[model samples]
Target: MATSKDGVKLDKSTPESVWKQILSAEEYHILRQKGTERAGTGIYNKFYEDGVYKCAGCGTPLYKSETKFNSGCGWPAFYDEIPGAVERHVDNTYGMRRVEITCANCGGHLGHVFEGEGFPTPTNQRHCVNSVSVKFEPKQ
Candidate 1:
């Protein structure tokens, strides 16, 4: 296991077969297959807590609670991710150009990121995350 910049352990769990054992069907769909949950149905959609949001696949800390904000985009929205915790890629899978975000460690899909939406955030970006892709750890 390799550790990330923040000292979060980055397990090299890869390939579909390996994840099928650790994640449930729902989690595997979103994190492994790069699928998205229905809007407004994620557990973190309306959740506002002071904690760290970690990648469900590799337990790498991805987002800080303070970066979370309600964008009313029907998903968990954050303005920023923990430094070096997430990776972005130009995604054109569905014929729509979007930047897809994934865990830097395990390469698990988190969600897409949108920029310049004119939100009241410092970064003016929305990191739309799938609740199934992450787990929350409340700040102690």
Candidate 2:
């Protein structure tokens, strides 16, 4: 494992080797290829426990339990992210305007962030993340 600048542990190996060692074909397809999983099928969809959500590829703390909210979007949604923990890029794929979110330390695709969610929170942001991109560590 390689620790990135933000202390996220990313697989330092080549993409092929990392693909072979760290992920299955399906996982690779969804995470590496930027494919979307069927909504409501992800393990994190209903996770309401208090915990820190880390990047699956690189164990960087991304979201805190306090920031999580039910966006009813079938994905694990968060109103905010750990400061400086993620990076956003403009995505022009599929002919849709989207903001691509990635682990700031490792450049791994986590998901996308959207605005105008109309949540009561001041940020009014929704970070719709893929379950496979995150691992939860329950708070004690």
Candidate 3:
């Protein structure tokens, strides 16, 4: 299992400060407090170049450019994530049961994952990621 920059284990359990230092106020609210950004209001929503998307909080590789698809969910959508790079938990915070996706390394929330997308992918999973949770590294 890959560890974070500060050596935090890439699992669901991690220290709070590890998350705090790596993320900003808005990032913390969305990733840790389960706050949602308004749809179609993220910078990455307009990104259309080729690149890999990584966790902004910990620099962990999350999604590849190839796996990205136009889901029209008003956020960056991907069909898959890097192997063993994320962890999911059942979130019941907002009076609904949803799988909350987080960075495996630092426990920073990326977004949610859902099934039955009917996309042309093996998993048929749609990872609705927050643009604030990720940064794109454009391919040269």
Stretches > 4 Å off in candidate 2 = 1-14
Judged by TM-score, which candidate is best?
1
lDDT of 2 by residue, 26-56 (tens): 6666657777778999999889999899887
Model 1 Cα lDDT, one tens digit per residue, 30-117:
9988999999999999999899999998888999999999999999999999999999999988789999999988999999999999
State the RMSD for candidate 1.
Answer: 3.8
User: Candidate 2, TM-score vs. the true structure?
Assistant: 0.86
Model 1 worst lDDT window (10 residues): 1-10
Angstrom error at residue 46, model 2: 1.3
TM per candidate = 0.91, 0.86, 0.82
lDDT of 1 at 66: 96
Please, what is the whole-model Cα lDDT of each candidate in the order they appear? 0.90, 0.81, 0.82
- Which tens-of-lDDT digit does each residue in 52-105 have in candidate 3? 898877678889888887788898888889998888899887698989998887
Evaluated against the true structure, the overall lDDT of model 2 is: 0.81
- Order of the predicted models by TM-score, top scorer first: 1, 2, 3
Clashing pairs in 1: none
